[model samples]
Target: MRGLHIVGGNQLTGTVTAHGAKNAVLPILAATVLCKHSTIVNCPDLSDVAVSCHILQHLGYRVQRQQSTLTIAREEEGCRDVPPEWMRAMRSSILFLGGMLARCGRITLCPPGGCALGGRPIDLHLSALRQMGAVITEEGDTLRCTAPGGLHGAAVQLPYPSVGATENLLIAAAGTPAETKIIGAAAEPEIIDLIAYLQSCGAFIEYQPGGNLLVQGRRELPGCLHRVLPDRIEAATYLAAAAITGGKITVHANPAHLAAPLAVLRRMGCSITAEENAISLAAPERLQGAGSVVTLPYPGFPTDLQAIFMALATAAEGYTTFTETVFPRRWAHVEELRRMGADITVAGSHAVVRGAPLSGAALTCTDLRAGAAVALAALAAEGESTVTAISHIERGYADFVPTLRTLGAEITLTEV
Candidate 1:
């Protein structure tokens, strides 16, 4: 196990360039199988990405990584059924089902694993692929999918805007030969990033009525060389880092992708200046707790940043309320925050936090976002702190401790 050893109280300052979106790159990695060759620039060097590359290699794709760049090529002789253990490593592995079914006409894999945030089901993904004429079966703990006659396009209406489902269906539709309409699709920036890569590979994908998507796919995609969008979630984390520590920092990212979180930061009394491709945040000496913050789909407060905001709320003045509409059972961090002296109460999806300065304590990271939350809390705490299970933190943010250290954070990683 590895942990972050942190000394709080120093104000973070300076600029940190954001890495590519982990959410975006995972789906794009899955999408690589549909292309003849793929070159992805600006991909983050994350453990999840390595897992994805290993999955690709398991499926007989030639994979190479040059720092943040990935070059992938296809090979015929290799494994078709992804190992159950590999799929169990990350939730994004579920995405390869559609890509494999499109490219190889079959796939066998078990349920994927990731941070537990309430009910994270892949029914939406299976239902969409089933709508596209793929036959999926349940055998014990594994799922077997086959499209003998090959997949065809069909209308897929998701119950909710599930980002993973949207990406899976998009990957399936991008390689199928016909028109597929996706309603209630997630319009997240990561989804847009995947769509852009698909479009570059001759996949006809565009936003239509009601924020839905249309995919007019072709049998053969020549493949593409695409660069991923900067990670807005990572940007939000850094901005929240500065906010919690009463500091000033600038993140090189696309401001348009961060309107939702930027609005909330400004509400918290952080001075935000956004340019076309970068955002500068100057936090006040003391943060003021913002009123009701709700997590909604895109163009609203993000569920991923809820924990970080809760940590920031701990150092703010007055009371703050967080209603997590996206993930009902994400309050695991509340208990961990309480360990650090945060006054918090949670009843179902609603959490009301009273602002108070935190003192360092041994913290446990429950999930990726939750890990970021506790780290942020430690950054604002009075004394030194140890946050274990930094592997969860590495699953999302790249060079997390080192990056924050460059921004003036007194943090280091200790493997144990």
Candidate 2:
């Protein structure tokens, strides 16, 4: 385990470029199993990516990574069963189910695991696969799925627009022999990037205006070079870190992908500038409280950034309410935040945060985003603070401590 020590009350100033999207690259990496050879550019160096690569290599694929680029090629007939240990490392490991089933017509794996934010049921994913002619059976901790008659196009409608389930269906449908139409599909920019990647590989996929995704499956797909989009959640975290410390920071990220967070930050009285491929934020001397925000699907407030935003609210003058409709147990960080003198009350799906002066305190990160929130709050505190369980932070953000240090933040990582 590792921890971060921060000497607070330093105004961060500098420029940092956003890394590639973790959410985007995981599914794309899984999709590579369907291609003969593929190259993914602008990939982030994160623990999750390393885990995804391990799963691919475990299945007999040759994975060569050079900095921000990854090349995957199918070297032999791959195994159908993914190592249970690898599957337990990250939630996105479940994504390989679709790709494995497409290439080998069978897949056996354990339940996927990652940050224990809440009960993220794979019932939606299982139900969608069963609708596409997959026979699924669960025994103890392992799940066995086989499509003997081969996958065919089906009219599948999701109860919710889950990003994982949407990607799984798209990848599974891409190799089927017919057209698959998905309703209530997720409309995230990551999903659009996946669609573009598949389209470039000769898979016909389109998004209709009214929340529909059409996929025309083929027997074979040719590999192509694809670059992932910028991580909006990571960009938003840096912006919030700057605002909490009363700093001005510019991020080299796509403004179009970060409209929601930028809009919310502007509502909190931060000076924001949007350019072609970069966005800048200048904090106010005294930040005003943003009234309330609800975490919704894409184009709405993202659930991933809710924790970081709550950290920013600690510096506000008034109360800020956060309604987390996406995950039931996302407020695990609220208890840890209270250790640093933050006044926060959690009532079921909602939390009311009262702004107050903070002092440094020892804290533990409850999840990935929660670790980021605690780090940002520590940066704004009056004294030194220590944050443990930093491995959760490393799962998403690449070079987190060094990146903050570049922006004039007094933070250091110590292994324990």
Tens digits of per-residue lDDT for model 2, 1-416: 78989999999999999999999999999998888889999999999999999988888889999989999998877465899999999999999988788777898999999998987999999999899989999999989999997887899999999999999999999988789999999989999989889899899987787799999977778889999999988999999999999999999999998888888899889999999999999999977888988899988899999999999888778989999989967888888888989999888989998899989999999899999999999999999999999989999999899999999999998876
lDDT of each: 0.91, 0.91
lDDT, candidate 1, 1-416, per-residue tens: 99989999999999989999999999999998898799999999999999999998887889998988999998764447989878988889999988788877888889999888988888989989999999999999989999989999888889999999999999999999889999999999999999999999999998898979999988878898999999999999999999889899999999998898888889889999999999999998788888899999998899999999999998899889999999899887899999989999899889999998799999888999999999999999999999998888899999998888998999988876
- Provide backbone clash counts, one per model: 0, 0
- CA displacement after TM-score superposition, residue 35 of candidate 1 (Å): 1.2
Per-residue lDDT of 2 in model 2: 85
TM-score of each: 0.98, 0.99
Choose the strongest candidate by lDDT: 1
